[model samples]
Target: MKFYITFFAFILILSILIGCNVDQPTDVSTSSIPIDATSALSGGDTTILSESSHAFSTPAPNLSADALEKHLDGDLEFEAIFVTAPAEVNPGLGPIYNNITCINCHVRDGRGKPPTVDEKFVSMLFRLSLPNGENGETGQSPIPVPPIPVPGFGTQLNNRAIYGTPSEGTVIIEYSEQTLTTADGARIHLRYPDYTLTDTYKPIPENVEVSPRVAPVVFGLGLLEAIPEETILTYADEEDVNGDGISGKPNYVWDVVEKRYKLGRFGWKANQPNLLQQVASAYHDDMGLTTSLFPLENSHGQSQLKQNPTSPEVSDEILDVVTFYVQTLAVPARRDVNDPQVMHGEQLFAQAQCADCHIPTLRTGVLPGVPSVSNQTIHAYTDMLLHDMGPDLADNRPDFRASGSEWRTPPLWGIGLVRTVNGHTNFLHDGRARDLMEAILWHGGEAEKSRQMTLQMTTEERDALIAFLESL
Candidate 1:
């Protein structure tokens, strides 16, 4: 009995030593890991499992019946084409404007690309501002200075006009190609776009700052807005005290409704405060339609500016539904979480610190009037704060608190489906990056480290990274 007991003890000790020597994965847990199958649900319960062309156009699956009805009503309004005023059915198009409808710019609720060489300016628009003048105080804690509007042309360039009205200007875009050789000897071609404002209605100042913007995806905005202001602030490292080389800042923009500066949560620069204002501004600026929020015409300062109307062109009800439509659009579920290459790429992504600014997960707080998007765990992959993207991506046009080099960290959810929905792979504020790799390579300033890390990746590793992104 004593010999048998000693032998069992020796066996148990040997087993313990073997367990200690066992190899394990070095990777940390990421959003890509399937935890109760929630990893594939990018927008929590609101996420829809659709890879179709209409992926971005779906209503949130979690919406109530009434809310879904409202979303459908808003969808009609979103697609409604506006004509010149003095007629019925969605009138008040333009004295001068960029597009005739919201759907035209945000095609299928997805992204917009820059106009091709032969195509007209259908979805892209330019923001024009004059150079800032001396404003005495230099050490203001949070300067919320508005862009100095170009005289007669206002803040945006209206490239198209109604009958008897001249357009603010026409833009000519020319591209010069440049080659970048990666560390792995992969040759990538990048197009440098040169824009010239030609054929203006009036002679504009030579120093006008022009910023080109392509319409971003409209889905998943409600979830982004639902993220609490305090939660977003927690991600801001303006001083980079952590030494990770990321310094994100929030853009404080004017809220006409609140009559004070509020945290900007939308637009390329996070220039608009909320979806209501964003939708209203789009109606006013893109289609030249006045709303209760922005009762003035977009062509306010120009000679062709219309007389002040008795009431707003778009009714409050119409505006509300349209805002609700955007706020409730479903985010598409992530794909290929189990794919080996994609899984490997996800690990590499975390290793390169791409998950820092493009934050993998965040939980949303309550968004008033939009219960479908509130209090949900989401994987939008964005910090939703402004970061200096470097001079290469700068427009040299400041909007509110955002400098020329700063841009809001746009959500990466539904990005992989942009091609399926919009039928184009063009990206960035100006649609300069032609593909996903080019977009990654274009990162600089706060993202310079990630860019350098990506550059040093082996060919297989780079392919894995892209495969992971495609899986999203």
Candidate 2:
């Protein structure tokens, strides 16, 4: 009789453990784990947390007075609206450009969203390219792509030109909804965006490939640039040698300044070498404003009839100041991190395998003139390497060494506060995901298992995961 009682007790204990693993009836426990309180200081010295519209636009909390003054000077240039030449103050606007000011697209140093069917492109821009060489039969293996710039229109299509010369083209964006049902019977609505470009002022090549990219937040960029190339390369597994199925690679792109191939670290595909180059390139393409690095007009000087701005619209001093501004902008601190649900969500974040590419922590190397960005533990949550995000998100547009389907894993540090700063929660390269859940659902390719794992989670678990993201 005692032996029978022992067997029955053992069976009951086994059943309970199984229930805890699978969560039979009740939800997963929302117990909090004791984490370092300083984890809230996500950007270290550069952290600033505010629930106001200006949250993302602040300078670093610990910057010296001299550094702060330069940041303010850059802010003036960054916010100044350019007009067609002739006037003295901030003259060179555009004979053709996407937006008049940098802040117009960045929107207080926060993410930009895609334009709707009725709207026109302002914050978002399209990349134009043609298949330069041979194509790989399968996307799993890497392929080489040398960009062939389009005639007349060049690399980017500017839909908004200054009055006379026709705008390059206009695009219409629409969405189609799909339903994903979770294992526990919860339904998720996924919206896919469809882009159609029309009203072209010039003839586009039949083989021209268009890539849409929205403006991303500009904070902590110097910190991202300060991370050593060797440190970032350690995360790259181009061949998937370890067989974990996550293959991350660095993009080797042309450095206009260095005039050599270098590890790409900025842009959607990690196409720019540093903050200065990224700034100069943006001025050339987005604003039709040139600098010493790019002295030619954005249109490739296709039309002589069009009035041109200064040979180089932005002076070297102004450009340097602007670079400093973007580099020194602060990353907001995490919110509600100690909440039980938020802590549970962090565990789920790792358990779901989202932390693989969106790496939670990294240490920075030294950066000259910007001590705040150097030698600090940060939670930017990115490997800073390119990965094939699957066919669902493929633009088939190649930039430098990045394949058509691959994209740099964007940082997730200040994501939660995007809405507070920009008044929107649109996520991803093209702003397809309306909210955090949609963004997670859009994950595929290397993140397919994670998406599936997130899909199968209970409502409470899903809420906890989102709660954790919101806290960040």
Candidate 3:
């Protein structure tokens, strides 16, 4: 009996030791050397430089007389559609909805900044259901079925509604500060979100799962579309080749028009494969604006609001024009990668291994009409996978198979220009991170090790690392 016990103990220890060493490559280079910035950018004009590295450009909107006319026309229509009160005249609105138009949350064609002390932004919250599958494989049923109430927000609390109607109930959040130490002895202080609502029209279900996402930038989407399915799929090696910690998988979405599952490359979980579909979904979900695809209204099990089968907002013309504007919006160029801090930050980013997931460069596929996006390289800085970011950042909600902690690595291109392009600088999914440093401090899960290494660096090293991000 003693011999048997000893043998079991020995096997357990061996198993743990083997797990530690399993994906660790013997060829892993441990040097903390920074790549020379000047040398990296020394040769050639914009074309060659763009091809080799990440300094890619987004296609300019066809500002032809026709296109400009459409933009002007759309701008006016969008403004008029959003600001006006939904009266008995506009019967299609709200059984339950977030806002009337995209502009409410996005502001302009810019990123939404978090609310100040006075009041919160008209933030949009999302709901998700748990998948009955293992390791994100095929399951018994996919797509969120109703009665599976989402957590916290109670199946998407539509905060704003038409006047004289019961405004989708108010939400109040409380915050508490928590300090944590990473593996490499770096200190991090973070604010934790605590939900509290003082008022309510309808009681929330006890177990609905919820997640909040700040509206992201609305530029350079065409380039993302032009990126070929092949190029994007190449990055999805579920069987990790180099034996790194990550094994990213490409999401396949159902394309109603094509009537098949297509490679997904849009949305937080890379769920929407194209801009047109994304815009269509946004119109239906965000504004309660019906379309050809989704003719039904979004109801939170309420009888007051219901779908209007013959609504004018579901017109094909509106969808096409909106999609046209979004696809043509150009991405701004990268900022100061030459600054000593930025250059040093770049080195630290590589050394600390942040680049594994946030791949610095991607070449786009062919686009026939647009010269700017076609066969061009862009610095998107993402692997487009659902990564487990640990409980610290987890919302405890699921999207498709994406667990609470999983999020697509957001593109870093033109992030430095947030202040310039959007006139705001809030960062992260819910606009929680105050700045780039805070964003870095909040990294966990697959990025936890890299974040720890970053925290352990000297102040000068930290500054440089931040500089590199700023340059991007």
Which predicted model would earn the best TM-score?
1
Instruction: Give the Å shift of residue 28 in candidate 3.
Output: 39
Q: Could you give the candidate ranking by lDDT, starting with the highest? A: 1, 2, 3
Q: lDDT for every model? A: 0.87, 0.83, 0.59
lDDT of 2 by residue, 262-376 (tens): 8889999898999999999888889888799988788765772264544677999999999999989887778888899999999999999889899999999998988978897
Model 1 residue runs over 4 Å out of place are 1-35, 134-141
Candidate closest to the true structure, highest lDDT: 1
Tens digit of per-residue lDDT, candidate 3, span 237-330: 6556766666566666666567676767677666676777887777666666667766765543454354364654546777776666666554
Report each candidate's C-alpha RMSD, comma-separated, in the order given: 14.3, 16.2, 19.8
lDDT at 102, model 3: 69
Off by over 4 Å in 3: 1-80, 83-95, 128-155, 180-188, 196-200, 239-241, 306-309, 368-371, 421-423
lDDT of 1 by residue, 1-472 (tens): 9999999999999997775333111111233345665767888767877799988998887777689789989999999989988887888888889988899989999999999988999989999988675321221235778888899889999999999888888899999998888898988888989999999988999988999999999999899999999999999998899998998999899998999999999999999999999999998888888999999999886788768567999999999999999999988888888889999999988988888988989999999889989999999989999998888898888888788788999888888888899899998999999999999888898999888889899899999999888877
- TM-scores across all candidates? 0.91, 0.90, 0.77
